[model samples]
Target: MKSSVIKIALILLGSYLIGCQQRPHADKLQNATTKKIIGYIAGWKGVDTSAVQAEKLTHVNYAFANVIDGMVTEGEGRFDQDKVNIQKLHSLKSRNPDLKILISIGGWTWSKGFSDAVLTDDSRKKFTDSAIAYLIRHDLDGLDFDWEYPGMQGDGNVFRAEDKENFVLMLKSVRQALDSLEKVTGKHYLNTIASAGFKSYLEVNDLGQAQQYLDFINIMTYDFVGPGTDTTAHHTNLFNPNLNGRSAAQAVFDHVEAGVPIEKLVMGMAFYGKSWKSVRPGNNGLYQPAVWNSTHPYRNIQGMVGQDGYVRYWDEDSKAPFLWNQSDSIFLSYEDPESIAAKAEFIKTHNLGGAMFWEYHEDSDDGELLNALFQSLRK
Candidate 1:
């Protein structure tokens, strides 16, 4: 009878252990299906690796690698530092094994070489070869092309009518190259792009064709209002009742209409705010005329809020937040925890892929905005 009791006890203990193991594995699988939170780390500013909360992020895009003379290379004079930064970013995997690190190539100033680089079959091949080589060298998980505008003169980039078609071709070439690499390594390499947020950019390129080659299309939904626009408005508002104005909702709708799958679209949030000075106080500075002021990181803006005569205001129609200094005639547009929470709800309701922010360092040292995003999205 004692021997029989021992056998039963062993079986019960074994079952308990197995159940414990399966629970965590099941939880992990569930987390995998949750929305992605992609953060763009500005390597140009030099990454403070220790500050990055890798657990909160699904992916980190290092901005940027540059295109020079039909080859993918490090930014001008940034090779040594970028290597170190990338290495540190790789080390972050110890904290979150599922984290992905990617190299973002081409930005507003570095995009000038794209037109010439992809102008011909041979040129496209060369660019593709260089991109793959760079990916291998850096031990990166993916590549993100931030080519600015494909067929337009972005920061005086060399553009042609052919860019509309060539843009798709370039993505196709990169996708094929990644597939080839996958065959040998048996590891999937992601291909993504930092797409422009406005309608004009979509009018020029065939994103429908482009999406087939991409894993995710991160729409730059911020910066609707910036320099050269002497107007005060929300730069990263989630909605705009005025159909003519720009908003995150409008951008997402346009992308769907442009043929990009809703499942693969990731909306962007700003960690920084746009400031305008010398503003007319009409309507509390919303949609009023003012001289464009310098941009401020959310951390700095946090200190200015409710201080220095800055009073925070919420726009119900747009589901955004702003700061107004009626005494000083200054206005600031930005994203806060409340606004980010609203965006998270929007993401869930729309069944969108996830949320992506322009940069990592702009948030508070304690990661207030990122925390809000992670909690809201994950919950």
Candidate 2:
């Protein structure tokens, strides 16, 4: 009888422990389905907070706070303006209390000091302390590191091989500091990074270790066909089977292979388009050589489509759209409502974390692209 009683007790204990383990997993699964819509707001563009559609976004990463002399600071000569912009961004919380505003430091231009800032423990602490202080002073929710390209030359920024490890260490220190702050303020803070979409970036850094310290990794999936590229292609295509080129689908796969969890990966979209001049007329100007290239905001691209001899064409394989102007030999690659809906479907099908876009103002005043994202992701 005692043996049977003990056996029953063992079974009950096992069931209790199994239930305990499954509870957290169930919560994680529930949170995973709640997608995030992150938008990068350019503070330099003079953020008109009133115009910002805060209700549609889950997070807004303000670009950018700069790293100066091993410390975090507002951009040089723009401190006053940055302070006002941050204040304005904070006011947006009134519209959507759940909205999270993060300060993104070290953009393409301001990433020069990252190498020296996190070179040693003391420097890392200094940088971390200043970052935490900035957050506290601004009453911000978190920090987003946008180190252009660690261990790689980006916009003539200083870089070293050690940057690969230091980058992880930097994130760890900041995460620890944020945790300590949470203990005092009773509020949780987030830590995220804007990672490059290219595979070369994964080769240099260890995202497997880095993700442990991050809440989300926002990949810049656009700019695949950047300036000086002789061939014109999709800058932010969801898929590209015909040509072996960069695509958002490929980038997400690379990140997953690089050890980033699919639940923490936020797919990036472009709110603007890339334009090339003097392109060959074959394939509706797809994969053709061009002499000059420039950027066009979505607001402007909307007006240009089907006007002034510009014809819009869709590549079914790539799941992308483009504009061809045979008279001007101008080819444009960009995302429209159709492409945005396709990407949103991709995100849902793959169970990705969510979506992020660059520069809020690039979208139309009527919030065309943002509405597509909200309807697809939020609704």
Query: lDDT of all the models against the reference?
Result: 0.92, 0.91
* Model 1 TM-score relative to the real fold: 0.91
Clashing residue pairs in all predictions, respectively, total 0, 0
RMSD of each: 9.4, 5.3
lDDT of 2 by residue, 155-198 (tens): 89899999999999999999999999999999999999999989
Model 1: residues with Cα > 4 Å off, grouped in runs: 1-33
lDDT of 2 at 59: 95
Model 2: lDDT to the true structure: 0.91
